[model samples]
Target: MSATTAGGEVVVRNAQGLHLRPATEFAKLAMATGCRVQVRTDAGDANGASVLELAMLGITQGVTLRITAEGPSAGDAVRRLIQLVESGFVV
Candidate 1:
């Protein structure tokens, strides 16, 4: 079998956007999934498993983020990640 890939776009709805706490949460979730994850924006792309990389994107409220995942659980991972972001990382 081959690794699968999944992706989706989500807009930041949090007032603070992706601050450290949320970024940490996002990275932790992405890492925990054990899949390759990438997050992209107009600024650029960043490794979804890296908080520093995610912060570097400078995401802000209303910014549309594109998340992609590849691996055994790509579909589920992408869906959950998109849900997380869309929910404004509200826990």
Candidate 2:
């Protein structure tokens, strides 16, 4: 079988934006899904599983991000990730 790819757009809702804590949370979630995730903005792209990489993107609040995931559970991974961001990384 071949791996599948899924992607969608998600907006940052938190006033603080993708700060250290939220970036770490997002990376952890992406890593746990066992999928290769990538986040892209008009500025550039970064590995979704790496907190440092995500932070480097400098994504701010209200920014619409394009997230893509590739792996056996790509679709679910993408959906969950989008939900995470849209929900403001609720703790």
Candidate 3:
């Protein structure tokens, strides 16, 4: 078996953007997927499991982000995360 790489783009829809709470949520989910995940904006990228790194990206609302993951679960991980961001980080 080989690890695969996959990604998806989503606009930050939460009113407050990827703040500590949402960033924490995103990080937790990313970690749960057991993938080498990354999230990026036009300006910079961050490790998906690091809330601090995600916050440093300054992901304001409406900022488009590309999330990539490399692992056995890459594709599903990308889809799962994209849904979270698209839903305004509801859960």
For all predictions, the C-alpha RMSD in Å is 1.1, 1.1, 1.0
TM-score for each of the candidates: 0.95, 0.95, 0.95
Candidate 3 C-alpha lDDT tens digits along 1-90: 479999999989878999999999999999999899999899798999999999999889999999999998799999999999988888
RMSD of 3: 1.0
Model 3, position 12: C-alpha lDDT score:
91
Best by lDDT: 3
lDDT of 2 by residue, 1-91 (tens): 4699999998899998899999999999999998999999887999999999899988899888999999978999999998889888985
Tens digits of lDDT, candidate 1, 1-91: 4689999899999999989999999999999888999999999999999999999888999999999999977999999998888888978
Which model, 2 or 3, shows the larger lDDT? 3
Candidate 3 TM-score to native:
0.95
Evaluate residue 24 in candidate 1 and report its C-alpha lDDT on the 0 to 100 scale: 95
| CA lDDT, every model vs. true structure | 0.92, 0.92, 0.93
Clashes of 3: 0
For model 3, what is the C-alpha lDDT against the true structure?
A: 0.93
Error of 1 at 46 (Å): 0.2
